[model samples]
Target: MSTQFLDMRISSDSVQDTPQRELTSSSLFPYTFGDIGLQTASVSPSNVNSVRVTLNAYVRLLMAPSSNPTIIPNATFTVRRNGTTIFTTVYQKPANQLDITYEMAAITVVDFPPENEVLLGQIQYTISVSTNYGIGLGARSFSGIAVAGGI
Candidate 1:
């Protein structure tokens, strides 16, 4: 089997000292923190068969009794491709934990079967976080690569 690289795209952002933004919501609503747009090369369905996407994020989870004694801090992270969800993760900390930093990473591969027609065009990937109490995002990175191979 042989494979060829078709296209690649990456987006990254970070804050120096403080978090980029402190997200807090009484309702469960996702806040988009990072996004990237990738233009895939037009190729024959027989030549391209898969796309790989990777995402990384640095976040601070804070749970303070003084701030919100009634509720425990929890956050849900989601990854979407063109508004469609592909992956999701959740982080929760006890009130006693106070503050913690986490480095999260996720990867996914989209494959097109031989019988199905391949769709290649503008693609967008986004990372979002939803919280109940409070959460902070320090950095985030998203990347994707399209490859051609026999499927």
Candidate 2:
């Protein structure tokens, strides 16, 4: 068995600041972080017996409590495989906290059968963030890897 690496990162400069009574959630474009939006990794159909996928997320935030010191943003991370939702998690933050960094991870395993395989098919993964209050994510990153083993 061997492993393949998948790296992704994304950043947005459009900062959103809303009050506790007027907060909204948004999704960043799905793609590799440093490169364009989509990234693909190969999956071996015939020789592989099972596939394992893992994800890691890092986020940077800029809190402006000085503007509305009573509100905090609730953040969540969602990961999708092949345009299908696979994992979701929420990031916890203290109400009075200022600038901070957040991190998370997810993992899953699946059987790889040659009968269901598509030629040159690739495994695609996406990471997105959702927030419920006033806060800005200055930068965000996601790294994923897949390991396939033969029977």
For candidate 1, the TM-score is 0.70
In TM-score terms, which candidate is top?
1
Local distance difference test values of all predictions, in order:
0.59, 0.46
Model 1: per-residue Cα lDDT over 24-118, one tens digit each: 76645677766766555565456645543334555444433336567776778887777778778777665576555453434454533221323
TM-score per model over all chains: 0.70, 0.54
Q: Going through the candidates in order, what is the number of backbone clashes in each? A: 0, 2
Superposed on all Cα atoms, model 2 deviates from the true structure by an RMSD in Å of: 7.2
